[model samples]
Target: MARPGRVAVAVPAALLLAACSADPAQPSRQPSDQPAVARSTTPEPSASPSVEPEPQPTPVAPDDLDVSTATGTVRHLAGVVGPREATGPAFARAADWVARAFERQGYDVSRQRVDVPAGESWGVPVSAGRSANVVATPLGFDPTEPHLVVGAHLDTVPQAPGAEDNASGVGVVLAVSAAVSGRRTRLPVVFVAFGAEEPRGPSDDDHHYGSRRYVALLAPAERAAVRGMVSLDRVGVGATVPVGSASDGDPVQRSLLAAARRAGVPAVPDPGQRSSDHWSFVRNGLPGARLGSTPYAGYHSAGDVPAVVERAQLERVGRLLLEWLAPR
Candidate 1:
């Protein structure tokens, strides 16, 4: 994903979907090894030269959502992994927790293990360690269409509870899986809990080891099987939904806009999220986008606890994911 360029003011799709007004007072957070956080948003972008078609109403309505479950999942994920880091006990536990969640959702889960040799972290070299990714593939779906792999990182920064930074995303992935648990779809969708999205230290380049590896192992045919990648990261603090940072012309972005419109969820496509798991898929020529809010005050800090997470925002993101999974 290229750095989000200046957005055009007049696309109806963007304007209609973006419902949140940027609170100047909202704390500003920089991309943390890519937090997948939004840097800007508007209620009405100026205006565009071309018009997009109006989205159709979806049969799926995100009503009576069990946000309590989503909140509970977040609490368990963030709280259980106390001060989690990629190569620690907490992260291992977190990864297992994620695998079980998908298994409970009826998918066959696989834990892909990878070793990182001694390498620089946060600008300093550190000893090598181990980590793994939790992945699950849908059953009984048509094999020809391609797979829609949706993921959220399971690891958090050192010393941070990281409720919004990522547990929020993990929770959404599980909740949405549950929401659509019994349904069938047009294509297979793999839900993943990515390990090592955050660097073992503050090093920017060291992050996203899991996703990059996943992309690498994809046989040319498997890469061809990838429909698109959608990442849910840090979407628990604001009313706005984080649109993925893929090229505006990417099929993933176009479908998401249509999905948001159908769900009637207010959203703003984030431009500054090229640094997360989604970017890994994009580099392979598959359209990818991350959904999240920006400037979480507690981002990469100790204050990012579960108590501050917004349940409604989690529900909104979950609903949107469910909507996207619907058959065209």
Candidate 2:
């Protein structure tokens, strides 16, 4: 997808959904050798944007949330993405876990395997193993109308336990699934655990393999029916820092802020620019936004593990998301 050239790209729907097969995991297609991690002599981005103070929400006492067990579930999910684990198996396990969690909650689930041709940037190939994207949609909903797509990428950068980077995001997705278990909503909700977000070898724009493929594969009607997308990336702990960032002009941004305030989370608008899974949908004219903390010290490092996440933080973020997604 082309970057927003001062304005969003308005490509024809057919052109946007064109088919291509750039599977990176295939050994036959991999360059005879692997390339070193693409280095950028590119200068660090100009002085980071100043963050706006987020609305200070009344702190809900821990007792307010029955989070002991819920937090355990989050930890278990973090363990599933242990550092050093192969990205393929790790993502597959996370996907299966999501499916089983939804099943236990009585929702019918479906899996969509997307095959996207590897583009210019493949960070570092990890066998381009068979990647799969998981989707679970509740039955008994009107299939003709647009649905809310809540998603997260289950994969991580190499060697990072990705506890805060994403396990936090996955944890939130699963937690919401459980929170709404057996409940009814006016709009169908599709929860997805995407794969191949980490850079692959020799492929540019290969960062979002799983999501890119899924979007490309969606039938025109299906793509058009998407109401909006919310991607959760790194919404874990804060450093007791008093800061937030948000773009008040965007409708999706406004909706998220409204949800945070309604749920009483001390969610300050993250003040800096960000790029995550949400970018994929937004580029496709699908309204979407991401939730995460920047300057994550543990990011892309071996030290990032399940222990890095804060349960209280997770619960608060989870509560805010569930409230936004709760049946209206």
Candidate 3:
């Protein structure tokens, strides 16, 4: 989640999907000064990108999402993992834990390595190091087929354990994955636990390294196959979920809002929210949005512990996403 107000970069025309605006004043994530390099994930010879007819399977029951499961994950990340700065060993442990969680649900998990150069984040000097994004896909996932991306950052600022900033987001994604496991859907979905979402420097490029690299490395076909993406960030504190995009009237946002209505969840539209991993996808021409609330009192501070997260909020978000993923 990079902060807004920075000038946008030009991506290759072949990769562009849509254009977005960058406005300032959002207390979002930031990036390091230097460009991060992306590395390949574990090889999967069987699953290759190819255009194919969409699958038309019988609708399966949606998973019964549990709030306690999401809460447990939040506690483990904020309490057990502690402050997981992207360059620290704690981040590595957290990444491993996330990958294992996906594997337990029988998904094909991969760790995409991201190399970040030394830079300053919020005036603090950061050392150059390696981090990885934990990516999970259903078995036999085909890139040519349309799919939805659900992602959350796994790293936290050094000053706090980041229960609300992101542990809450990760917990929701994991809960969704667990509930949907073994269930067939109208569209395939991919889950990513991003690294380095916190700003490493003053520049916008300094943040969202995992998401930026993930989108950058995608083949054109793969990019086109993404129907929409949702970034679940800081969802544990607000009374109502805030579903926002780069600007107003985004189809993805509309779909999410409609889903919320059908699911009987309280949600509101928040336009121009360019402050999370979803912005990475939106700026690159894909339909993307963020599901988060207003900043909490402990934002980027040590006060952002598990106590700030609310169970009801987590349940609301989990139910919203579950309904959104259901076959239309």
Candidate 4:
């Protein structure tokens, strides 16, 4: 782990600040305060008459798996990397750090650079300067098949240090990589650290540069091969999050529900498709799920620090994800 005091320089292109004329009253959204479980349209194996593999005795409880990793990873990401606003060196440094973490765990890593056209905004008029995406792929026993993508954005809005907004998610991905590396699995896993999820310009749709580009570049065959995808956004916020669907009848919803049941984590359903990195995959016809806590009070302000994160909630997310990603 890097020392907390080692402050890195912010990259000039990455430092595109919000316009001074930007609305001061329009703060980022807060975590939702909804119940943890709701009936959602999660995808299930469509009526196949084929006999399914008998569910093996649960090898390990998902909570146990989550508890083993979430606390430390969330603390480190939220605590160490601190705030990672887009276009800054802190964001770049975090990407590098995550890449190294993957390498140390014996995964083959690759980096894809995404240069946001200057002045590009999702729907907002402001323009973002630049960005990058760091990806790590484990040598899968099979390469022709699409890999499981577990990703978290590395950037945050300015003003606050986005510890819970994303540092927590990054930590969970790192911890999961470490935990699953040696254990044999049927599918390949890709851990990606996305840049510029925060609105670079004014609109929300333009914010997910890293993910949008990655999804766009994948071959159609590759895109269709995706078994399941999960985007960990703001997972560090300490709350019992009701899992939501990008769409009401999306297939990913079924996987999450089953995972919650298998992992024994209490989760509810949400129908709203709060824009996040997962939207990229959704556009490409991939089954994707977004996991997050309800709105928090201090989402974009300076108050979103490590202390604000709920360790137990993070564990629930991690454990459920493990169940979802575990061999079916």
Q: Report the number of the highest-TM-score candidate.
A: 3
lDDT score of model 3?
Answer: 0.88
Candidate 4: residue 156 Cα off by (Å): 0.7
lDDT (10s digit) by residue, model 1, range 1-328? 5344534445655766664555667676666785656546668676878888977533433552467767987798777666667777888888887788788878878888856555554443445788788887766644345878889887777767889978888888887776556565546678888877876544445668888878877777778888888988898988888686756667787778778889988887767567689988887688888888567678877888998799989988888877788777
- For all predicted structures, in order, the TM-scores are 0.76, 0.70, 0.81, 0.74
Residue 290 shift from truth in candidate 2, angstroms? 0.8
Among residues 3 or more apart in sequence or in different chains, the pairs in candidate 1 whose N, CA or C atoms overlap within 3 Å are 9-46, 9-47, 10-47, 10-48, 122-203, 242-292, 244-290
Q: How many clashes (backbone atoms < 3 Å, residues ≥3 apart in a chain or on different chains) does model 4 have? A: 27
**CA lDDT, every model vs. true structure:** 0.76, 0.65, 0.88, 0.72
Q: Is candidate 1 or candidate 3 better by lDDT?
A: 3
Candidate 2 achieves a global lDDT of 0.65
**Candidate 1 structure, TM-score to reference:** 0.76
Tell me the spans in candidate 1 whose CA falls farther than 4 Å from its real position.
Answer: 1-65, 117-126, 140-145, 200-204
User: Which of candidates 1 and 4 reaches a greater TM-score?
Assistant: 1
Name the runs in model 2 displaced over 4 angstroms: 1-70, 84-87, 116-125, 201-204, 239-248, 271-274
RMSD of each: 32.0, 33.3, 32.2, 36.9
- Residue lDDT tens for model 4, 276-298: 88888887678787888568887
RMSD versus native structure for model 4: 36.9
Candidate numbers, best TM-score first, in rank order: 3, 1, 4, 2
Q: If both were scored by lDDT, which would come out higher, candidate 2 or candidate 4? A: 4
Cα error of candidate 4 at position 301, Å: 1.3
For residues 212-298, write the lDDT of model 3, one tens digit per residue.
Answer: 999998999999999999999999987899999899999899999999999889899999888899999999999999998677799
